[model samples]
Target: MKKQITSVSLGQNAKMAAALYVVISLPIVLVLAAILAISGQAGQALVVLVATPVVYAGVAALGTLIGGWLYNVVAARVGGFEFTTAEVKAG
Candidate 1:
């Protein structure tokens, strides 16, 4: 059997990225923001909140890549199979 390629969507990737970032950064985000705000660094905290989505997207993309890699490596060894998402075009 041919192994299929894995593909991820940009929007989906972004959303997932944001979710993963939040999951990973929640403690830090909350703590840093609170400290910044208390120290009259509210502007910085706001900036961070505004930038959260973008940061999340990057994290999500990284996560997808890592997940795919792990699946490709470990899945094959454990389950005797792999995946592919390549599509053939006919003219």
Candidate 2:
């Protein structure tokens, strides 16, 4: 069997994880913001949040925490980004 190598190294994994979290949060926020927009309050906030990148950062933080916890209980089987190492190993 061939051993698959991971490209993330070590320290970079943290950054990669964070980036992954942000990427994951985006669709959720857009959806949430849209829902909020339709409702009124969240929509307005969403507009301001969308205008400023800070809100995205906040959403990412919240999403990471929620996503992390949810992954343990529910979403573990759901597909999402995997670090390069996992793909090589899986292949």
In terms of TM-score, the best-performing candidate is 1
lDDT values, one for every candidate: 0.68, 0.54
For residue 76, give model 2's deviation from the true position in Å.
28
Worst 10 residues of 1 by lDDT: 1-10
TM-score of each: 0.47, 0.41
lDDT of 2 by residue, 23-47 (tens): 7667776776777777778647666
How do the residues 9-63 of candidate 1 rate in per-residue lDDT, one tens digit apiece? 4456556666777787767777778888999999999887666656765767777
Model 2 earns a TM-score of 0.41
Clashing pairs in 2: 36-43, 37-43
